[model samples]
Target: MTTSLRSTLDFLLYDWLQAESVTSRERFVDHSRDTFDAVLDICERIAREKYAPFNRTVDTQEPHFDGEKVTLPQCTHDAQKAYAASGMLSAAQDYDIGGMQLPYTVEAAANSFFAAASVSIGSGLLTVGNANLLMVHGTELQKKVFALNEFSGRFSGTMCLSEPQAGSSLSDVATRAVPDGEGFEADPLGPRYRLKGNKMWISAGEHELTDNIIHLVLAKIPGPDGKLVPGTKGISLFIVPKKLVDTEGNLTGVRNDVALAGLNHKLGWRGTTNTLLNFGEGKYPVGGEAGAVGYLVGQPGKGLHCMFHMMNEARIGVGMAATMLGLAGYYASLDYARNRPQGRPVQGPKAAAGAAPAVVKDAAQPQVRIIEHADVKRMLLAQKAYGEGALALNLYCARLVDEMHTGEAALADDARMLLEVLTPIAKSWPSEWCLEANSLAIQIHGGYGYTRDFPVEQYWRDNRLNMIHEGTHGIQAMDLLGRKVLMEGGRGLTLLASRINATIERAIQVPALAAHANALGAALQQVGAATKAAWATGQPADALANAVPYMQAFGHTVLAWIWLDVASAALASDADQAQPSTAGRMGAMRYFFHYELPKIGAWLQVVSSRDDTCAAFPEESF
Candidate 1:
């Protein structure tokens, strides 16, 4: 599994994305191919030794809270510490803060190993994202007290969003953050406040992996009338620590007013703790108060905007996690198909004159490997197409992150626009398709797939959570069709089309890729037309009615373009050295184009016509 993944990473990083070229930029000048390889080597080794061996251990053992503290397996603690020691928590940060200043592209690829090894064991996505958000919007002192410690792994972080009542509807959040005291504005760590609310489904919400858990909470600050403001615009980000910390980053030796309400027993990702947490419930009040003390991150009422910095990063991370799980399933199933021989091939009645024979074999022959069967091959290919294609898409988004930060003016502008257009697709497409890959993997495992004895069923369960978290498929669809495509008056979508067309132009020059190039070109056209048609009446209600289908069609078109781009690159890849992996990619690309691309048309039909069958149906009928 590691070998296959390593080879794929090599091809994606060097051959396709040209990660080495980023070294030309001043931010990454200290790095090179050697430094990147060293990091990758460390991550892959740690993942294999510390994570892969313990995948089942953590899953079966799970995390248990015994009222006082959460008890995780010893192996989980070992893995978490090892990950923190890896410097990956700050791999993309500056050199001054104990970072390698590596490009996000390399960082993302390096992290995939750990995710594939065990998706359940935490990998610092929330911590890194939390710190990164602070670096962008935090004050100098706040950065020192909070973000820096998070990057150093002395502290872990989580974003507290969905409340039990609000769930996905931020506008309905009831969490309130009022000024802590009269001198709150004078405090060094930004404005201080006392928060009272309950957050639900918080991952890594309660853990002993780090010295402190800095929760970036979202809450509403009341207006002058002492009434909590409504909607997301009123939402604000806060830094609520599990334990209070002073200016010098020393532990204040006092627990915050935060209390763990209960643990959520999830179907998957059990290694990480999910909790219902209560703030300001008088559990452990500070200074005789009944509220959780928190420091403001940005301006009040702009909390969602600030939290979005972390949320967007998390969305991409979620996409990568989904891709790795799908790949893990694919690898497990592939191994089973190769060695577990099944029934012999059934021969045809007879071949017609001058016609090809379907099979030239006898029933009395030895049973062949399941891989020899075309149906199994089809399932394997679909998994490959979905998993690898999703990986490439996520990595491409990461590459854009590098460009957005380091490229020249015009290039950075283009990268920024393209990223906005692709983020939803990047998050949702893998979550939707790669899940199917897991299902196919289970199907290939036959009866064993259903039982817990095999890992494939676990992979499916683990992946099932991806679509619902980070933003559900429905949310992403609305964001894409209702907002992303129409963002900046469709400027982002236009930038995306330009990039896709450039790939089409390049792939069309190659004989073997021309057909796919044409198909993708048509797909791009269909999606563009559907985007316009959906909103032709300029009524958001009608336009977003079939948003999920539009998103599905758009995501498929984007993926088709990605596969074509990869296949075009594979043409120039080393013919002998990369023959096997390269051939596999080529086959996967073909599978995507042949079997997956056409399905977009049916999905797009609803979008183009603004079909209202589902939306128009009365809820009472159900």
Candidate 2:
């Protein structure tokens, strides 16, 4: 079996995780290095032995539904079952739920392996994690009804946010929830109102893999005045089940009210089910013998807020998954490069004195590995920067999660605020950049990358879904610039800037990193200036128009900070390693600063401009 490139990246991440524990002094609830490594080892073994071997087969023999039942490749089912039985599905949950309850950071690291192995198969596990999150925040009765079933792997869960009309705009969602006759006693805890609507693009919405599916749906509840409550204020979250539950909280059978209308054949991630669902199909009795059964989560008007809880977690998952896919492609390309011999350098002279030049077929000597080429190295470096950098960023956030939960209260507050500010970037930037890495991996493979014969192409397809997953790049941009940065009088943004400045101050003292430190400081100031000017205008839309540039600016700035931290830590470690490798460490640091850090200047320029090119175009231009 070929060793995974992702595993090597995870090894690096494991080192970072340990460093974070020492530096942050926060013990993670779910994972430590030992536990994380063991899980990753298991994932690596399973991914190589079980999943990777079947990836192409699963892709060719995609899941199929014949009117009544859906059938997937046996290998796909086996892989899914093996992953579930390994207790990986509950990584983010507490141990009481039959889970290892690994830390999100550790789980994120492990997921990289699975996604790299087979993105489509890996998605099933992600949906399970998503369901578990909702169950944690859900009511006790809801837990008994939904969470318990999920724990048993009897019911898979999906987040249903998009509609045919409301893509990213939740406020525009037209799905309606009406009060029924005292609600239905599907579970003894309490009855719930009937939910009737059409939800589109629901992942795992209607699949035969599990006995039931729990959909966390968003819909508008009627107010006392009868009109839709203003905007999202009228919106509420509901737990809509594919089958009605008994008073004993047992899923009896399929309920006709919720029917699978159609399946969406997507560009990629094909092993997972995506369905168009029609509620209130009028075929079976629902809540109080009415329409579809729906239970309210959190509060009536606070549905959108509740959804954000899951959305944030999902966003990080998206980033991690995308990064993993790219890492997989990178590893495959690297392996192929190292082993595949092609033409020699054109600059080299022919072999001397009757020796044959390196050539193919019956006439020649052995050729050099493709990896020796400079262009191949360039692609590898780009992949490393994006994939490894994203890994560092996500793991850093996970460490913050630990700090938020276990550190001193004051420190926890600061960590939480800083994490909140970085969340969008942590989620969106990697999805964008690592997908680029996947694309580069394909390029490295040349023509083979375009065919199923090479996994890099599949990696590209899988990563493409990430652009629309959790949230789109545009949505994330708006959230970062319009809300998180400006929220609470820029408290989050200030906290983040303070942290970056602290690193900048430290790097400034190091001769090797001093210049990049100065550049990052200047970039931070430019970002602050741009932010202030946007806010000063008091036009949120204009501020949002510049959101994409702001994301790029802030992403690079934070990445520089992270790179500096890593370089400093590496240099310090080299000094302590007895047999010092300070020179090599210094070279890597210099390469990053001189070659990578300068890009921040260009990013800052665009951000500071506050250009309204997006707004300048009229709606009719197209």
* lDDT minimum window of 10 residues, candidate 1: 572-581
Q: Model 2, residue 574: displacement in angstroms?
A: 3.2
Per-residue CA lDDT of model 2 for 1-622, tens digit only, reads: 2354553445456443563363333334344566767887887777777788877777777778787656777887778667766666776566676666566666666666677778787644435654665675677777767776676666778888888887887888877787766434343544476767788888777666677778888888877776677678888888887777775567676574777777888888887777887777665665335467777777778888888777887887787788787777777887888888886754445678888776434325557788888878777767766776777788888778766766789998998888889899988888888899889988888888888887888888878988787788888888898889988889999998888898888888988678878987887888888888767668777677777767877887777777777767665555544433345334444555566666766655555565666778899987
Model 2 misplacement above 4 A: 1-14, 19-33, 123-130, 183-187, 224-227, 254-256, 283-290, 346-367, 575-592, 619-622
TM-score of 1: 0.98
Model 1 C-alpha lDDT per residue in residues 77-175, reported as the tens digit of each score: 899899999999999988988888999999999999999999999699999999999999999998999999999889999999999888899899899
Error of 1 at 566 (Å): 0.5
The CA lDDT at 247 in model 2 is: 51
lDDT of every model, 2 decimals = 0.92, 0.73
* Stretches of candidate 1 exceeding 4 Å from the true structure: 349-362, 575-578
- Highest lDDT, which number? 1
lDDT of 1 at 79: 92
RMSD of each: 1.8, 4.9
Collision count of model 1: 1
